[model samples]
Target: MMLPWALDVARERDIPLAVFWIQPATVLATYYHYFHGYGELIASHAADPAYEVTLPGLSRPLRIRDFPSFLVDTTGGEVGKVVNAVFCELFEFMDEQRRNVKVLVNTFDELEPAALAAMREHLDVFAVGPVVGSSAEARIHLFNHAGADKTRYMEWLGAQPERSVVYVSFGSIWTYSKQQMEEIADGLRRCGRPYLLVVRKDGRQEDVSRCLEDVVQERKGMVVEWCDQPEVLSHPSVGCFVTHCGWNSTLEAMALGVAVVAAPSMFDQPTNAMLIEEEWAAGVRGERNGEGIFSGPELARCVELVMGDGARAVEVRKKVESRKGMARDAMAPGGPAERNLRSFVMEVQSSDEARRKDTNTISPPP
Candidate 1:
């Protein structure tokens, strides 16, 4: 969203600019196509949940619900409209300078080869991630130590059995309504799994306090205001993650080998959920009702589908385990992600040197 301003700063200074796309390459391709030619088709069917789009280079067609929420958020009022406008403006800026644009995506090469190749047709694209682990480690060092609440949760996790805990979070920005919060709490309780849920203290805590109180009183789960997410996902007891499919959270789950029950809210989240469930086969997407609320029963069903002693659960776990190995390999020394980063750095350095030489060249007086 802030890419336009960053581009302006880079241009004014004559510095080389590369877009470090925080989302997956598939999402980047979707957005690029939406701006390039498919905006009309998407806009016309924005409210049609069953409408499917076959984007170029995607192996499967995507339903309208699977798109980034901004594209299908017809009833979201002013904020939705503003966000949609911002995306259009941002992509327009990129489209205007497409020739000069280079994208460094936070995904590994083997994960989405087709999508990455499609994006390279229009932009200088590099797949350079699953890079959340090191940054997560760095965050631990910068913070000095975990807080009291964090420590408490860690201890609680220690008490749980291996691969027996459900970790629930919707990233930091999204807050649920009282009804939605109650539904989520009820769902987790119904699933009968020991769970750790994070509810932000962003002034909406009082609204859901009753629901949370019930959860703790029954000893069904533990709720905290905030936590070091990487720590929770890396915990041995955490088996399934009920997530909103935020890019960072998705990557962390992938890197750590935790199965996900996607409950995506907005932005790139829905797309990430699609990748998680359909493309990667690492998890399942929770079903939602007409109101777009993931009801308690549906949530429980999805959770069981991933965590129960079922064939699907076993397959999802196997796929997630495989991807975890792939993520590690991508980040290892001389791996694809590392090699891509090295190549990008060398290109930038070469450009900088050439520019310096051009600036310093002495010309005879005309």
Candidate 2:
């Protein structure tokens, strides 16, 4: 059976492996570089009051804000540790297209057309993406009777009135200061809306929730460690989503017809927020702390703007159609995604005999 040697067997059989990408094309474009000016670019942003960066090849101005948080670590980030510990072997397992294999990125093209175009010049990079959105149909009925009970979050939303609830979550990984969290709590209350907060399970809760105790104790609010988001957003009760503007969450909200209050933290998040507010007309940007929501009244105003029947509802709904169209086109049969699949098959077919003769490698590490 060669059960344990499945990867080797596949390589021997000339099966193509797919190395799906989730992070932005910009983050990855650096991998294929000998001189990306990465260090100088970061220094320029941090040093300049204008907060802009210009790299060797990019055409547009870079915001210190747009760079990924890992670079800011400057202190030899976990990337090095992770690279040595994990990616070293992982990258080795890949039979790179350099001109042969196919690269499947989960980002829709419109979101990063510039970087995507740059990447296409290098390899067979297909934009069949926002892979997260491929499951939209399943998310639409998120809280509908079936999975609601298991999530433990469905019942709470039913108790609120239509468009009266604001759901707050900063994604699976993001944090903020105690002072900033308190300010946002006050802002939400001032905005005069009922809210459900999904605070992180980390130690910051007690400090961050300093101002939330009164709201939590009262029936006007609820707080939990986690939530069933699609279920929560679909609830007739949730009026606005105060989110980190994650690509998946933003797209999922669109799929389920929920409005968003964008509060992007880092990485491509701000870019997503920029698109949501400036381009997509889907959400209003929230007051931001360096890597989290700035606590205060501005945060409150964002909640109110997107709540029930505001100026944004009509425009927001209409623009989502464009995004949906682009997203669907990527995943359609014989579209970019499908084309990548076909190319991958052909590559494997042509290389099977060569790989079978070489037994130096196998599967990626778990």
Candidate 3:
């Protein structure tokens, strides 16, 4: 969101700016196409939810519903208009800085090789991720928990058997409707697994608590306001993650080799979910019913598919395990992420020196 301002300030000051894209490179490419080439194509089909458009880097054709919500939201509504304007300005800003632009993506090279490569044609793209701590000592928690103790959850997780718990968290931003909350609770119960579900302490907490009161009291599941996600994903007891497919959570789950049941809700989530299910083969995307809600049975099916002793489940686990090694290797010292970061710094320094030399060589008009 601060991208446009950052670009403006950097350009005005002649400072080299590298964009740290927080979402997948695929999402970056989507936005790039939206402004550069595919805006008309998207606008033409905005009303057709099932219409499919194939982007350059993506392997499969994506339905209109799969595109970023802003693109298909052509209702002439103020929110849609504002979002469209922001993205348009964002891409225009990138275009203005085309020559000297660098994008530092929050994804490992192995994860989105094609997307990263595709972006490189337009900008200096670097895959310097999973941009997470290599160890507990290096971890940084950006959010203040308001003096909440994290040890209780950790201890509870420690008590569970290895690969026996289902970890469910839909990031902090989106709140589930009461009906959706009940559906998820029912799904978790149907899965018949010990689970840890993080429902943020928001307006919906009380309602969500009411829905899950029986489960919480019966020790079938534990619902917390918040927990250290990375720590939870890393725990041995955690087997499958039901996530919103937010990039950070996606990468963390991949890094930890925890299989996922992607219940993507919005923005880049659907894209990430597609990548997880299709490209990486690390997880399955939960099926949404006609109302665009993931029904309890559908969620249960996805969880069982990911966690059950089936061929697909085994394959997904294998793929996740392999990618886990790749993610760790990429983040290790002297690995791809570190090497690319060092190279980016050097290139920026070199560009700065050359620019200085060019300035010094210019003759005064006076």
Candidate 4:
């Protein structure tokens, strides 16, 4: 959406512009195919969750429910209409600059090779991420209020058996409703696993403590406002991640080799969930009810399926372990992602040098 302004600024300054797509490359391909020819088909099947669309470059058919929410059921409200318009505009601009522009995505080549290859046919795409993992030495801590026992959760995790803890977090946004929180509490209790749940301070107004009072009292579960996500995911004791399926969270889980219990609600989350469960075979998506909530039983079932001593869990674990290696190789020295990023940097430097040379060359009596 902000691409136009950035492009204009770059052109005015006679500098090159590259679009940084924060979502997965598969998502970019989905939007591209939608604008090119699949829009009408997707729109016609907006109401049908079971309707499947096989896009040209993607490996699997995506059900309507697997698409980003903005691409489906946009007739319900103005928010959808506005979001759809923004994407339409963004892609229209992308079409115009297809030959000249480059897209740098926050994913690796090993993650979505098909989508990346498809996009490269139209636009210069670079896989320059897993762009997290910078040290926190430069981080400024403004909100440090975790009731002063900040290390308590880490301590609790240390005591648990390896691969026994169920870590649940729904990203930084989207507070859970009281009913949702209660259901989650019930699910965690029934699952009978030592769990760590993160409910941000704003969401605590619903009295989640009271909802999970029994679990907390029994020391089976611990609810904190927030914690270092990479640290938590990398913890030896952490087993499965019950996530909202945000792209960053998905990448973190994939890079760390943690099995996922995806509970996606909106936007690109469902698409990411599809990638996790269907394409990567690293997780199971929790089924949502008519009200778009994962009930207690359903959540419990999904968690057990991923984290239990079952054949499916074993399969998921093996796949997850393989994916961790793929992610590592993508970011390793001289790997595809690293090579692509280095080439992009060299291209930019070459362009800047040529521009400078041209500026310095006075007209020879033109």
Candidate 5:
């Protein structure tokens, strides 16, 4: 969304504006989630693993138990508040949302053909993804400031053995209570996998005293404020991601052939986690307590499930690997995503041109 706005601003300013997009058709399938009754039915289905219900638009029974945990939040709570705020903000940005809104998502039409088919109606969306594969190269020039250890992350991974280290990072805005932090730390320790944890420098009460140091010492580990994630995930030494299921992270993990353990925090994260864990068969979902508390043991189980060389891990790893080809093809020169992007550009320009032609502030007929 910001990308589109920034491009539009550049266009309005008559400055250089280049827009690239990936993923159009896949996202529309999600709008089906926005329809009334869909969320609840999905939730009802999720509450009972054997529960079966019809998807709003798609004519199929989405097993209740397999539904993403966001169904719990659909009943109206903090999650519902967030969803409502998004709709409110959508109203506020109704004009802006439409104004040259060139869109991209981290998915492929092959992986989400049904959703993508639904999205073709929008005309401005492009699905050019698994961007993380191209991102390490993309971030090469992002923060070349002095004293920045750009390659330090890479070097760290180089030191680890193959598929031995697990990389952990809660995306940009997840805050944990002190106990939750220790819970995560404990899980990492119990899992006994070599790991790295990136804790953002936010005011999220992090009292890691409870066995955090012990856990790190027991297994060779690294904890930092932040690290070049795409680089880390891309490394062969990195086997799995215990993630918040952010769209970028999901795509990154999938692109790098790193299995995901979805500990989704909020907003679209749960939905994204669902896509990864349920729809894509690329990850295991963490256990959420009745109050939405993600149990450390469940987190650990998901991690081991993804990292282990078991049947599930093999299945998920192959699924993730398969998505890479789809994503790569989507981003190619004249692929669907690229074609959609060109069309999006034309639509935005056309809409702008039409608005300019209709800008006359005529007074009402006297």
Candidate 6:
């Protein structure tokens, strides 16, 4: 949405511009295809949730439900209309500058190699992430939780056995309906494991309080409005993360070697969930019922499948551990991300120097 204004300002000021894509490289590729050749196919089947669309460089065909929520949103309301328009314009802007622009993606090479490669065919795309580091103090928390005791949760996690707890959080933005909250509460209970759930105390505080009262009273779980997610995921006692599959959360869980039970809600989350369950083989995606609600049994089954004593669970853990090592290597000093970033800086500097020399050489046109 801000791309047009940014580009205009950069061009007017004769400055260099490099787009930093905060989403995964896979999503960039998806959007690239959406605007390039697959838009019509997706638009034709926008109303059909079961319809699948195949794009280049992806191993599997994605259903309409798997596409970014903005594209698949049937709501013709103002919000949807504005979202659709902004994305269309953003892609058009990218297409116009594809020859000169390079995008820095917030993802790592080992994470989405194919997606990165696919985008590189059109533009210079660099994998400069799992941008987060492993330092607890270096973490960035956007929201301010006033007077919240952090040690209480840390102490609770410390007391639990290694890999014995299910950590549930649905990112910071999305709010759940009362029914959905109850279902998730029931699912956590059915999983028969110690759990820690983070339900933001936005508008849904009363509902969340009501739904989680029993579980909280039983001491089987704890519900807080917010916490340090990376810190929690890094804890030894957290075995499985029941997540919304947001990219940051997904990357954090993978980096910390925690297996996931993906419960995606919107946007790039469904795609991230698919990659987590199918591509990476580090987790399982939960099944949603007809009304698009993830049922309690489905959640429990996914949690157990990833966190249980079964062979699949063991295999998932091993895969996640392997990826965790890869993520660490990618973010380490002088690693791929750092090297690519350095190269980009050098390229921009060289370009700017050449431009300055050209300007100096030009004679007065009076």
Q: How many residue pairs clash in each candidate?
A: 0, 7, 0, 0, 13, 0
Residue lDDT tens for model 1, 113-164? 9999888888878899987756554764322233437778899999999999
TM-score, every prediction: 0.92, 0.69, 0.93, 0.92, 0.74, 0.95
Model 2: what TM-score?
0.69
All candidates in order of TM-score, best leading: 6, 3, 4, 1, 5, 2
lDDT of 3 at 116: 86
Worst 10 residues of 1 by lDDT: 139-148
Q: Who wins the TM-score comparison? A: 6
True lDDT of residue 243, candidate 2? 86
Off by over 4 Å in 5: 1-53, 56-106, 121-124, 130-137, 140-153, 203-206, 209-211, 350-366
Identify the superior model by TM-score, candidate 2 or candidate 3: 3
Instruction: Report the lDDT tens digits of candidate 6 across residue range 1-366.
Output: 245688777657756668888888878878889888888889889999789888898767888878888777777677766766777776676677664466899889988888888888887787888876577577667677875678999999999999999999888787878888889888987988999988777736676667777668878878887888888999999999988899889998888899999988777898888899888999999978888888888999999899888999999999999999999999989999999999888888888889899999999999
Native-vs-model 1 lDDT?
Answer: 0.85
Q: Model 4: per-residue lDDT, tens digit, 140-247?
A: 344565463548888988989999999999987878887888889889888999999988787776466577565578778788887777778888899899999999
Question: lDDT of candidate 3?
Answer: 0.84
> Which regions of candidate 2 deviate over 4 angstroms?
1-18, 26-39, 49-60, 72-97, 110-114, 133-152, 159-164, 175-177, 200-212, 254-257, 289-293, 308-314, 328-339, 353-366
Native-referenced Cα lDDT, model 4: 0.85
Give the Cα lDDT of each candidate: 0.85, 0.62, 0.84, 0.85, 0.64, 0.84
Count clashing pairs, candidate 1.
0
Where is model 4 more than 4 Å wrong at Cα? Answer: 1-4, 11-14, 138-149, 207-209, 356-366
Candidate 5 per-residue C-alpha lDDT over 122-171 given as tens digits, one digit per residue, 9 for 90 to 100: 43446665555465445643323344465766677788889888788877
* lDDT of each residue in 1-366, candidate 2, tens digit only: 112243455467656555566665655454332123355556445534347655433445556555444443344656644543343333334433243345677666675677678877765676656564333355443223342233445677787788788888877666656776677677777877788887655636676666566657666677776676766777788877888887778766765566788876655676567556765687788766555446667777777666646667667756665665666676677776677567667766767666665655665579
